[model samples]
Target chain A: MALTIAIHSYKGGSGKTSFAINLASAYASVGKSVCLLDVDLKAPSSFNYLLPEAKHWVNDIFEGRYGVMDVVKDVSKEMGTKGAFYVGYSNPDIVAVRGISSKDRKWQSKALKLLMTAKRDLSNAGIDIVILDTGAGVDFTSVNAIAVADYVISVGRPGASRQRLMEQVIGGVYMPLDKDCYIIENMCHNDNPTDLSGKKFDLPVLASIPCMCDVAVRCDNEVLVLTEPDHAFSKKIYDIMESLDKITS
Target chain B: MTDNSSTEEMIRLLREISGKLDRILIQGSADNESDDGILDVLDVMTLLTLPDHLRTTATALFELGSATADELAERTNKERAVESNYLNQLVRMGHVAKNRKGRKVYFSIGEGLGK
Candidate 1:
């Protein structure tokens, strides 16, 4: 089976989705079978960035209208890269998000189980890595997704308030999870992690990625790692990919 | 419902899923999922449940990625005679694959419903 990874954060706008896509691309570049799931059911972003015309979304997976395999879009050919690369999108329509995450206890549990089955089914299809770009902050779907994951890479920004919030989350929310959890401080002014780390947060900071216009400009449309594998931002992302490869399978 | 042992296995599968769902509620964290219970609903059940022998064999094979009959026998805790029959039936059912090397055979999960 494959290792499940959740790109999560306690704060919004931490670039978790961007990191997840690039990391997935990096893994696929190495001939590893990978799938990037846009499971942020509350607010979908990957479709806007990668495939705006996606017909099947993660919403269909939750609605039980489609199996995980049915909705999987093979992005490897579009990526113009090697290995198997797939993307499962989430419905960007307001109605879909409302229905998926609305106040219905029964529906929520069933939906969570379906998502778990989705990952399991994907692994059954010989995918070596499954990465979920979950919603920011503590949400039911995010927690359930993380619970089923084997490894978690929590992304955060470099700020006093965000740092404090993360410290609380790492202990309160993320600590109890019995999985290999790591942190990434994104949007750093410089590459120096020690300087950006500031106060000692009680979590393993895996990579400190700098803010680059190169990334921000292309993120709206193209994937930086796929388009420019030798860019500065792409190098840092590879550094993260290499670092994760060592710790995780 | 099919047989006495099969009924017990169905119950076990339900309890396994129900208990896992309960953990989300038990944790009671901000993001922890809450549910009344699986016992209350009839239609909302997810996590496609399989028959007793099929589930034990299929889940073990899918989870382990691949296994030989002997290895699967240990995983599902069945006698060699019984387990071998189960594996062969699964292969014939198109739920599993049988790879042969000399006299040894390795079994892997195949494209079966809910597998």
Candidate 2:
């Protein structure tokens, strides 16, 4: 089976999706089959990043209208990778988002099953890694992803409030679930590196990515690791990739 | 032979045959249970009865069909002892069944469950 990873955060705007796409791309760049799923049904962003037109969305899959393979968009050739790269995008339409948000627990449970089946199918199709860009907080959507994932990368910016929220989530949710959890401190502005030792939880820090003004201002969805290989942000993402490799290996 | 000696021998043989029958009946019942418990194409949402942690463990077991605590620990990124604890919890909840094979114990979803 492929290693399933859910990139989650305590709150929004933690650069979770960016890290997920870049990390998926990093894996794909090295000839590893990768599938990046935009599971943040509430706020789908991979569309802005990839801008690929879709015949189907994850919503349709959850509703049992389509299978994962039907919705998977292969971009391996476009990515110029030796291995395949596939994406399962969430519906980005307003009605679609509202519809998913309105889903009850029963629907969520069914959706989780569908996702599990989809993951197994992906593994059978030779995908090496499956990365889910999950919604923030303790919502059912994000919990579904966390439940299915083997490794969780909880991304949070460097701040007291974010840290407190992160600690609460880690202690309350991740710890109880006994998941292999890691923290990624994104958007660190301090000159000196931020220390994670003071945190309440014991999750290892995967990377402390410094904020880049240029990358922030670019205002486009192109993966920095793929577009600008020399960017500092790209290097940080690659470092995260290496750390993941070392750990998962 | 004395009459009492012959009767005692007959009783001993009957007791021995009864014990063997009991063992065979017990083994047959277990086999029936195993056959009945073979979950196939089951809806994964049937696991909602369990807590999230146990549900995750059960789901992992469903994926694996059957696995030891060590193998489940690898899949779940948890300590072997932790996985063992959760597996035992599932066993208690009747969501999973454990069997010993050699020195290793393997667990799988109990009945009417699949990934």
Candidate 3:
């Protein structure tokens, strides 16, 4: 089975989706077959970021117009990488179903089945890494994504509220799954301390990303770190990805 | 000499009507596609209900997440002229706040907008 990593945050503006997309691009840059899923159904930004180069109809997959494999588009070229990259789109109705009920066992089961189907399809296409960009906050969907993940990268900013929320999310919900979890501090400034060595959180800090203007400008159109490789921000992203590899491997 | 039960019933009826209005506003849909125009006007009318910075930041944050300053800059090739034009629009609309985190200037959706 491919390694599945869910990039999640308890609060919005934490760059969870950006992290997931960059991580997938980074993994693919190293020749790994990668797949990314935008689980933030209400605000599906990945498709907009990865479109033009992205193939495989999202609506087709959701409407049964095409199998999951048929919708797996190649986004590696856009990232300037050699591996294959595909983005999975969520159906609004399914998202509504998941959001509408926490106690609906059937909905949960069906959602899991859909995820598994997606995994199987990607695996068949030789994907080695699966990254899910989960919705912000400790919602039912976020919890479900965490539960199913083999590894969870909790992205957060530097603040007490963010930390407290992270603690609540991990301690109260995800910790029970026993999955390896890492914290990534985004939008870090030069004045801010690094390593978060003694910051006192439930998880260890895997990476601290400095705020990069180039990156902010690029959005999700392409991988900033890969494109700029030598820029300070990109270097940090690369270093973080390397550390993540050590932890996951 | 009004009965208490009748008064309570009247209050309940008003509450139901108010609840319906709230739903309509939240949903932003109805036979009045033009209702959107009216809602915009109402939002402007109630602009005093919130602080100017708060309104600006709220709009900025949503727009930022839907996209981002860095992404916008990249689309325009990091040209200050183009970037300023876009950023100015955000600033004017109160959807983004300008902040300097170091040498790099960052525009984020105003404060307390993160869900």
Candidate 4:
């Protein structure tokens, strides 16, 4: 069975997508069939990072325009890596982006069911893990995605509003939903203290990643962990993946 | 540390960050800035839009497991005829599942909306 992990944050610009891609690549590196899905339909950046040489999109699969299997692009060959590393990207087209956020009640239920079916299909495809990079904050896209996840890694940055919202969301949303939530303090300034797992938040702090310009540059170009495995940022990504491998196994 | 102190520190950090802005852009937490309103097909189905009696009936069935229209009438305080009409609407909406047993209509929240 595929263990679905959702990388979420209460606000944007928290390195949420970057971590999702890094973790998925890490799992693939360890000889696991991994699929990184960009469910952040409104403003998807995963397609920009991962090589999107495929035709079908995640939005098409989500909106019932295409089958889940049809949209999954086998990216392991392109990335020059081993194991299955597939990417199901969201539609970056202007018109299609506007249509994915459906509000109809009956349609919402069916869409939820579709996501469930997609998970089953992914598992049937022998995918070891399905990592979802959802839209930031508590939209239905994020909320529903988080609800379905087997595990959640909430990415956070050093800010006031972001921190406060993270606290409230954890207490009000995640706790009530009975979710296993782990916090990752991402893009930390070098000057700040690390090891905030329990000192700062109520949940287990999975990893503390320092702000690195090299990773940011790669994020703008290619998947950082895959392109430059020797980089410090990439090392942290591997460390996180190693920790996750233990927990999920 | 107590959750209250941690929460206070979080509020202080929030204020400190907002203080760096050239001018006030946003006030309070972003939780209130939910754009997930009923503007599109993907936004969550609003529970607020559901009829009060239908919601009550669903809640009653959710707690009771399954109840006949007459049993629901006593719990929801609606007459048999009135309760059955609402029950039929809920069944039509798929909010409640109906089973027939010797002219009695038992309703319970089922499938997608039940949980």
Q: What is the DockQ of each candidate?
A: 0.03, 0.04, 0.01, 0.07
lDDT of 1 at A82: 85
Q: Write the per-residue lDDT of candidate 4 for residues A1-249, one digit (tens) a residue.
A: 799999999889888988888888888877889988888887876555457577888877667887788988888877766789888887788787677664444455455556766877899899999998988987767766775678889998866556778887886666654568888989888665434345445688888888887676678777777877888888998998888878877
Model 4 stretches with alpha carbons more than 4 Å out: A190-201, B1-115
Estimate, for each residue in A144-187, the C-alpha lDDT of model 3 and write its tens digit.
56655778888888776567677777765555455688888998
| Docking outcome class, model 1 | incorrect
Badly placed stretches (over 4 Å) of model 1 are A190-201, B1-115
Best by lDDT: 2
Q: For each model in turn, which proportion of the native inter-chain contacts is also found?
A: 0.03, 0.03, 0.00, 0.10
Q: Estimate each model's TM-score.
A: 0.67, 0.72, 0.60, 0.69
Angstrom error of the Cα, residue B38, model 1: value is 12
Instruction: Give one digit per residue, the lDDT tens place, for model 1 in A94-195.
Output: 987787666354556456557767878998899999999888887776766775577888898787677778776666555554357788888886533332
Q: Candidate 4 has which clashing residue pairs, if any?
A: A101-B42, A102-B40, A102-B41, A102-B42, A103-B40, A103-B41, A103-B42, A160-B14
TM-score of chain A of 2: 0.95
Best candidate according to DockQ: 4
Q: Which candidate is the best by TM-score?
A: 2
Give the per-residue lDDT digits (tens) of candidate 4, residues B8-102: 99999999887866245553333333332222222223422455676556545543567898898898788988889988887776566788889
lDDT of each: 0.73, 0.79, 0.63, 0.74
Clash total of candidate 4: 8
2 or 3: which has the higher TM-score? 2
User: Per-residue CA lDDT of candidate 1, range B2-97, in tens?
Assistant: 699898999999999999989977677533322323222211112223345765566455445667888888877788778888878777655566
Task: State which candidate, 1 or 4, has the greater TM-score.
Answer: 4
lDDT of 2 by residue, B20-64 (tens): 999999999988655444332223334543577776777777667
